[model samples]
Target: MMEFRSVQGSLIEAEAARNRARETRMRRALQRILTAAEGVPGYAPMNWSDVAEVAREALDADRPAGSNR
Candidate 1:
């Protein structure tokens, strides 16, 4: 019915927003890695997983243990 259609539309919109946010994150992460490697010697390009892993490690290191989010 109409209610079902509304729900489906809302779900689609939410998914689109989520996709956009993910794309933005990926772009920003790539920019960070590229900027970091710009002047370094023997710099090699990395895949998304590699950059994400590096980012995650940095974030973890910055946070104090047993700290609540």
Candidate 2:
């Protein structure tokens, strides 16, 4: 039905918006992390594992106790 299509479209739009917002936040976080790292003596660029670990730490810090977020 037309109503179902409209609802589906709205959901798609919302998901796209969420994806965009998440990407922007990630970019900002990466920029900040790299900027800080640059100030450290003998700083090296992060490898994939290093990046993953950092991401996990950040998520854990932001996560509420007993919440899966």
Candidate 3:
């Protein structure tokens, strides 16, 4: 239900738009990493809960209140 218009400008413009979106995404990721490194607290410090549990318990040592461990 559409028409095919093979104008060269349209293709170039589309490529440019895609590149802009990619750059915006990259910039956002960089900003988030910087903020979390600065300890803004918006980011969770741990990843992969199951994998980190051993390390967490080793470092924390103290069990949280009412923990069933």
Candidate 4:
């Protein structure tokens, strides 16, 4: 029951708020996964930086030499 120009705020502001909520949900789910993984048998914890570096190395190994990007 309102005119288009009478809307709450800019479209971008609404979209950004929506995106922030989605990211919060995603972070919660990811944290739950990590917590559960920590309790699994034979699970070992490492620094996130170490994990990230290892993941990057694995990706690099998967790629062919001289391949751009």
Find the candidate with the highest TM-score and give its number: 2
Per-prediction TM-score to the true structure, in the order listed: 0.59, 0.60, 0.52, 0.44
Q: What is the lDDT of residue 37 in candidate 1?
A: 65
Model 2 pairs whose backbones collide: none
Which segments of candidate 4 are over 4 A away from where they belong? 1-9, 40-69
Local accuracy of candidate 4 as per-residue lDDT tens digits, 9-50: 567688788778666655654554576558765555556775
Model 1, C-alpha of 42: deviation from truth (Å): 20
Better-scoring candidate (TM-score), 2 or 3: 2
Q: How does candidate 1 score on lDDT? A: 0.71
Instruction: Flag the better candidate by lDDT, 3 or 4.
Output: 4
Please give, for residues 1-69, the per-residue lDDT of candidate 2 as tens digits.
999999999999998997786677677668656865676656566766777776776556545688875
| Candidate 4 CA-lDDT value | 0.60
lDDT of 3: 0.57
lDDT of candidates 1 onward, in order? 0.71, 0.72, 0.57, 0.60
Candidate 2 least-lDDT 10 residues: 55-64
Clashing pairs in 3: none
- TM-score: the better of candidates 1 and 3: 1
The clash count of every prediction, one per candidate, is 0, 0, 0, 0
Model 1 per-residue lDDT at 41: 57
Off by over 4 Å in 2: 40-66
Total colliding residue pairs, candidate 3: 0
Q: What is candidate 1's TM-score against the reference?
A: 0.59
